[model samples]
Target chain A: QQQVKQSPQSLIVQKGGISIINCAYENTAFDYFPWYQQFPGKGPALLIAIRPDVSEKKEGRFTISFNKSAKQFSLHIMDSQPGDSATYFCAARPTDSWGKLQFGAGTQVVVTP
Target chain B: DAMVIQNPRYQVTQFGKPVTLSCSQTLNHNVMYWYQQKSSQAPKLLFHYYDKDFNNEADTPDNFQSRRPNTSFCFLDIRSPGLGDAAMYLCATSSPLGTSGYTFGSGTRLTVV
Candidate 1:
């Protein structure tokens, strides 16, 4: 019953390396896709988001690559740093759902020196 | 400076005891949502309030309830705490007219004994 599915439950990467996390959804009604980053004992913060009209959106080192036809999207973190180490969640919201978000299983990313 | 605030960062309650978590927002958003996140898992939506109208997820337990007495405040009440119910409760807010994304509070970690 999970609407959104994410891969690579956990990953480790060296500093300055690239870290990628992928997510997919089966529902076409989802129009808004957002990625959240969470640190231990804190709330998930919005890192970046994208609408279906655009194929990709980038904010600094964080990028979200989306494919509408394929029903898939991925997050890429360039120049991964220790500060970026945390749990990442991909979420989708349906157009008519009144802002309700369905989240993926989440991925734990670790950056090593 | 607008943000969502959750009180009682940590709570421990005996089994079968009732507990309530509070959330407040200064952003004056039109929507407020409560989510439950277990260890190393994605958050699950429990319910939401849209300008005083309550919407509950079908899978949410009967023991859980929510109230939004006013625009700035929302409360989550657990009628009876159980060991299985221990988790982090997160509160988030967003404006229906904007696409900026939600702002989340730090969350309340509940431990059942």
Candidate 2:
């Protein structure tokens, strides 16, 4: 079973607009949530992450709002830019595990100029 | 700066032949992981090494195996690859210290003819 499910397999947004991607999980044991951004022909890099203890975490233009009760989380990018166009992934794992991760099907975000 | 590296970004092999993908890290992370991702699919964890201990996912194929010769190097070996195995293989490393994020290497694209 897919532990994490993400929506909008592909999305297109105009520059300077807000971009949002959502993910839901089935495992309640997962406490750490992380989002990753990947470019073509490149590896994925950590964009932002949030622990279940916190409701929201923001860094620069990227924000991760987590709803622990809902077992859902989302990534919001404010004032989107073309540089932000890429694949975004939401992943989760149990706090006690090592290396075993469950990832959401990625969302391909395109910010058009 | 420390980084994770994957060798031979792309490989093509015969259906019944064996293939190996290598990953190395300079971050001195105690944990290393391997993931398989098909087109537009989420990354699925195959296995991982925590220090000297190895952990494998339940559904991972018997054709897949892994070896970690030392702290910085890990290898993924496929014995007689199938066409369905053609996908992007990602390698990642992390320190068991805490809830911090893992560093990922540019994936190795494996194709079986």
Docking tier of model 1: it is: medium
Correct interface contacts retained, every candidate:
0.79, 0.71
Q: For each candidate, what is the lDDT?
A: 0.94, 0.90
Report the CA-based lDDT of candidate 2 relative to the real structure. Answer: 0.90
Q: Write one digit per residue (lDDT tens) for candidate 1, span B28-110.
A: 99999999999999998999988998999999999999999999999999999999999999999988754767899999999
List-wise, what DockQ does each model earn?
A: 0.78, 0.68
User: lDDT tens string, model 2, A1-113?
Assistant: 78888988999999999999999998558878899998886778989999899999999999999999899999999999999999999988776664466788899999999
Candidate 1 lDDT tens digits, A36-85: 99999999999999999999999999999999999999999999999999
RMSD of each: 1.0, 1.4
The TM-score values for the models, in the order shown, are: 0.97, 0.95
Looking at candidate 1 chain A, the ten consecutive residues that score lowest on lDDT are A93-102
Whole-model lDDT, model 1: 0.94
State each candidate's clash count: 0, 0
